[model samples]
Target: MSSDALLHTPLHALHLELGARMVPFAGYSMPVQYPKGLMAEHLHVRAAAGLFDVSHMGQLRLEGPDAAAAFETLVPVDVLGLGLDKQRYGLLLLENGGILDDLMFVNRGEHLFVIVNGACKVADTAHIQARIGQRCAVVPIPEHGLLALQGPKAVDALARVVPGVDKLVFMTGAAFDWNGAALYITRSGYTGEDGFEISVPGPWAESLARALLAQPEVLPIGLGARNSLRLEAGLCLYGNDIDTTTTPVEAGLNWALQKVRRTGGARAGGFAGADKVLAQLDGGAPVQRKRVGLVALERVPVREHTALQSTDGQAIGEVTSGLLAPSVDKPIAMAYVRTEFAAPGTRLNAIVRGKPVPMEVVTMPFTPPRYHRG
Candidate 1:
């Protein structure tokens, strides 16, 4: 690896031992795929269960006398209304309603537990510190490690090792004792499946990972498959699909902004970019570029940054995420297209390698999500 390559998580050595092909991603050396390859790994996770080491993600806690009120000034979500033990997805916004990052906030007892992307951890921490300052205590959980167990059989596989896991519904979390180690397990994941993300101390990560893999339905997956799975599921990949230049309204993520958080309301928590986001909500944004799914007829895989053009040869948008969908058996992609051209079944052309490939806008989650919402 080059010196410019980012650091590795504690499970890096274990990945090497499993014959994984390592690659630099999100400022960390991560396993992009094991010997099974991306397609096989993706199918494995969809059909059975797969374990992923996501320790590079940043986990932090905010606590203070007015933690919820103080934290609301930083993000648009209404944290004060969030019930205990419930997790909500939110976005850190700029003054212009642009997305700084997408994060998950969980009301853990008296404090708030937050998780953000690893690539933007430094900036996110700095932003939080600068905004909240002395109003709240922002503590980084550096000694912790994150793991994801995903797939159709994920719940059953985890229940065998960590008992009582079946009781967890989607977006709920609980403290559990796993193989003599304390872990925080959340009934949530990025793959649009019934899964759990476990946060454990760094030292116990390897042991817990080994135990999960010991299950017959569990296999170790990597970043390559992770990307493909999220793409097929129509999930946004922060920096690519959404970033500081894209607003929540334009990105079709207005659902993340709860009704209570809207402007001109008694329950509204005044946060950054409230004016712009609220205005867009009342009088729809002029340029609503939504993340829509696309199916390409050409066999060639369409990668990111590919230009999307209308059938009449007019440029519409660009592909933010693309891959050969393992489940759909076709080249599928997600692009931010103008709202006028974002309806499902709209015909378009993707310029892949100088050729005009016929494409069609389709509904998201190319495959039906098999999440166990109960």
Candidate 2:
């Protein structure tokens, strides 16, 4: 990692003015939390609304006659079926069936809008540019600020600012004018809460953030609580839970792959590793490993890379993401275990700091999602 001062988002100054404790994440200086602490921020978003600065994420636009066709060849998701203004979560896979990264793509009628993980954005953009540069125009939306307003009251809070945000359904995006600035607002988020991710030009990011924060039900949140909140929601952290070594099938993300994409056809078979992925789908590959939720028996929180052992002392899997879930008030973890040992209520043990701690396989989302589909 570069030792130089990390990159700063458009809202970096505002976070500092608000007394946030900044840390390096995804090569950018980001807020871990405000003086209010992680727990308060976590609960604030769960009950009301919390604004997060996520501008470190990369945004790209693919436009041309062949934009959709070109993009469809990169991921397994059915981009052609994506309706105008609708967004779908997808992954970029290697030719050997390994995942490169997971992303969200929106079909915007005349173009495609893509948002990818911050850490992998550079590499991801380069890969897409290399593959589709000849077919479509790939333009990076520079210095744009992405804000996430999440929680049950998010719609109410945002409606007070943007006026019509409540009408947008889940996985939909639109362009709106906010205080004289053109903004792109998407009704999507990672915390499993009903929320919107607003994209604004860098010049007006601070003003927009302040306006959203002025809402009585809105507060400023940071990355610390964001991780825990997503954990409780069972959302995967790109590099941690889902990586190059993991496939969508093993990561429990099969829903993201459309039926048409899975079937070998003129459009479906063109993407990388389509043969391997389609084979896995058709032959019903052995469930050797699967992502599962773990409830820790002890107070000690299990961290990533912890080895999971079967009841008889055989290694079955490893923890990918784990933390003491502040929202749930317990230690919850996500691990990939052999399919035979992944059923709910199956007994297992996680090695925590050299001590074997009892754990059990449980259904994910540790908590039910609160997405606003209607």
Which is the leading candidate under TM-score? 2
lDDT tens digits by residue: candidate 2, 1-374: 45366998998889999999999998999999999999999989889999999999999999998999899899998998889899899899988777899999899888999998999999998999999999999988966888999999999989988988889999999999987889988999989788999889999999989998999999999999999999999999998999888878788887888988877566656788777777776765564688999999888799999999997899999999999988788999999999899899999999877779999889888988888889
Candidate 1 colliding pairs: none
Candidate 1 C-alpha error for residue 335, in Å: 0.9
Q: List the residue pairs that clash in candidate 2.
A: none
Taking the candidates one at a time, how many backbone clashes does each contain? Answer: 0, 0
Error of 2 at 245 (Å): 0.9
List runs of model 1 lying over 4 Å from the truth: 1-5
- TM-score for each of the candidates: 0.96, 0.97
